[model samples]
Target: MNTNVTPLTTVSRGGDAVLFAIEMRGKKLTCSITREALEAHFWLERQANEARLLRAFSDGRKRIVAIAERKARRLATEVIKLTSQDFER
Candidate 1:
């Protein structure tokens, strides 16, 4: 239960509330991600954004993968920080 361990979330059932699991230090923290106090939110926007990025870089091959991997890392860090706050509640 070390506060220092970063929480990594995997979101599911995205439609008003998301069922999510956060793992850290070989342990998992389960929680919900709500939209406007509701239990699910549509993930279409996120999917569309990722699709757009992929289409735009369709020809970039290794370059695109590298860039995307970096972006993924940054996004993962951001999400970990965001979800970590849920533990306070």
Candidate 2:
């Protein structure tokens, strides 16, 4: 993980939504959001995102959940990529 990336939040679940943040190599890329409205899309996105994250981290470990922000709800169907290294220390 980069020393410049800062994670605004980790994993947050409430009501029917999940929220979190993505930091890579020490830089905040963007916030993410997952909710019922975009559950299907979010799931798919999460798969790809996790895959990339895994490769980037490549620690042979797995991420338990996806991170997102409430505002990202609108971009659920779009593609989003993140890595553990992005978070700042």
Candidate 3:
């Protein structure tokens, strides 16, 4: 499978930055931004999926959908570590 990786965004809190990965196909991508970047990535994925569904056939779109889902899940898990609530748990 052809894979392309690119840095999407990054979230910074305190002196540390949390990087979020944007994986496409088998490729993995990451970057650093502010906490708002996480939310933006989620929103961007939603919009892109909507556009993709309208333009691509169902059978050809699963890979992109899966990639987005996987990235979102991974990002959420990592973000938890940067939160104060993580220590409380």
Using lDDT, give the best candidate's number: 3
Which clashing pairs does model 1 show?
15-40, 15-41, 16-39, 16-40, 16-41, 17-39, 17-40
In the range 1-89, model 3's lDDT, one tens digit per residue, is 34343433333344233444545445454433322322233222332333332232233224433444454467753222322221121
Q: In angstroms, give how far residue 25 of model 1 lies from its true place.
A: 1.4
Model 3 bad stretches (over 4 Å): 1-53, 57-59, 77-89
Candidate 2 lDDT over residue span 1-89, tens digit each: 23222333333333232333344434344533333223333233343443333232222112312333211243552234333332222
lDDT of each: 0.32, 0.33, 0.35
The alpha-carbon RMSD values of the candidates against the true structure, listed in the order shown, are 12.3, 11.8, 14.4
Q: Please give the distance, in angstroms, between residue 69's alpha carbon in candidate 3 and its true position after superposition.
A: 1.4
Q: Best by TM-score, which number?
A: 1
Residue 19 C-alpha lDDT in model 2: 34
Better of 1 and 2 by TM-score: 1
| Per-residue lDDT of model 1, residues 6-87, tens digit only | 2332233443333334443454434343332221112223334434322322332233223323333555442322121232
Clash number for each model: 7, 19, 4
Candidate 2 off by > 4 Å: 1-16, 41-89
Model 3 RMSD, rounded to 1 decimal: 14.4
> For model 1, where is the 10-residue window of minimal lDDT?
36-45
